[model samples]
Target: MSESKSYTGGCACGAVTYRIDGDPMAVRQCWCRHCQKLSTGGPTHNAFFMADAIAVDGTLASNAHAADSGNELSWYFCASCGTQLFGASSARPQMRAVRLGSLDQAHELQPTAAIWVQEAPGWVRIDPAMEQHPAQPPAPPPQNQS
Candidate 1:
């Protein structure tokens, strides 16, 4: 995707900024506990982005953690300000998890799926139309490796 249709976002303090181009691959809610704590400090919520569709700038802070699956998940946030921007798994090296709330037009992006639904709290109600998976789905088969 070229830089034609741009989406601008920044941290709460404006210390970090970035832009994304093109439509995202999947906009969905995650019931993963990690997402709950990261997004709202509560139950998980919907966020959207395509792993390969975003081109971002501005050096954001990052924290790497060993997820429940034992893979390292790197979370990117504002270095100057603690604003979580995105996350990624080394296992799924090709994609990114962008914070939909940071989008310039967040209302336009609605969730399509809900992963890790078995962990979803009782209070968090989601659309029944969404396809709910109980846990992190199997990673896509590797296409490039030496």
Candidate 2:
């Protein structure tokens, strides 16, 4: 069998770092207003993985708020440089969304879906090949537990 792939990355200032074993369960671009605000008017690209797959080091700061779906969402960042790191939702505590920009540059992952398209700005042009969702789509199937 092939060896499981591992990905590594850290915050802009290198104060926080993380490693993820295996591949991501899903990659998506979110255009929700909250995401836009976080991304400075652009979509937030994320790679969702089984929460257990991620191992982080160093202190992290976080902010939690209720989402439109009623799920409590929390964003984690490097306390020093303020670089966003990961996001988690109460609706799927077993999953964690790693900000794409936080992943190592060598990683090849890319968003396969665009969600909350209804909230995308008129000037934004989503890739025609990507699966589009006017709003939140169904959660990704559960990852292997073993």
Candidate 3:
């Protein structure tokens, strides 16, 4: 098993902060239209974690939208700096999709897959090693209950 590590980070303006304990569930790059719109450069790098593993502080604003995966997605961000934070999906209430860029060690969480490749622009190149999906990939089975 991969060694568990803790992470801490915040918004650009320093108004919001968060901490994540232990390893995340999954990490991936999202190229969906919504993600593209939300991204500053290109694909949105996302790291998924159980809600209980995250601890956040400060004010945030959120917008709920229907995700391509047929889940209701609530995107949360720092209200002051407009920095995207994490996305909460109703379909997976226990899961929180955090914006990898907001992590202090964002580079450590590399994506293993790319989703919504069909919506990516022609200029975008999908990584050869990462699994690619045209749309929403099949979700893994829910975590085993202890």
Candidate 4:
């Protein structure tokens, strides 16, 4: 839809290089507590993308945590500098939540939505135009039927 969109990113050390073929999902700033704590900046903002749409090279270290959905989310970070790069959830195996800061054009991405706003600090404000979901989006319709 966006002129065959494409994007690229990598780890802090640049050992790992990655690419995305399509437009990102929700380019938003997440003010959730976990995000605030884990993020180097004031809060954790990211440009989410479909896992299937991403092509990554190199390696990364991950830490799994229980997400609000009661599923374990694998947070992939650079083993070298501990820079969080992306996240993948077991519940939605088809999506990869890439940290916006890790992208080559991070500033170009503007958040279109907000999630977990309740946890957002008072200092942060979000646009009302974006859709706000209490938690991760519902799973897309099952592609195959048993």
Each model's lDDT = 0.70, 0.92, 0.86, 0.75
What are the runs in model 2 whose C-alpha is more than 4 Å off? Answer: none
For model 2, state the Cα shift of residue 121 in Å.
0.7
Tens-place lDDT digits, model 3, residues 1-146: 56678999789999999998877778999998888888865988888888888999999999999865687988999999899999888888888888898997645788999988999999988888999999887764455455
Residue-level lDDT tens digits of model 1 in 62-91: 989898778999988888778878878887
**Ranked candidates (TM-score, high to low):** 2, 3, 4, 1
Shift of residue 56 alpha carbon in model 3, Å = 0.5
The residue pairs found clashing in candidate 2 are none
Q: How big is the positional error of residue 79 in model 3, measured in Å on the Cα after superposition?
A: 0.7
Q: What is the C-alpha RMSD of each candidate to the true structure, in Å?
A: 3.9, 1.4, 1.9, 3.4
Could you tell me every candidate's TM-score relative to the true structure?
0.78, 0.95, 0.90, 0.79
- Where is model 3 more than 4 Å wrong at Cα? 1-3, 144-146
| Cα lDDT over the full model 2 | 0.92
Best by lDDT: 2
Which candidate has the highest TM-score of all?
Answer: 2
Q: Between prediction 1 and prediction 2, which has the larger TM-score? A: 2
Where does the lowest 10-residue lDDT sum fall in candidate 3?
137-146
Any runs in candidate 1 off by more than 4 Å, and if so which? 1-5, 43-53, 138-146
In model 2, the worst 10-residue window by lDDT is 1-10
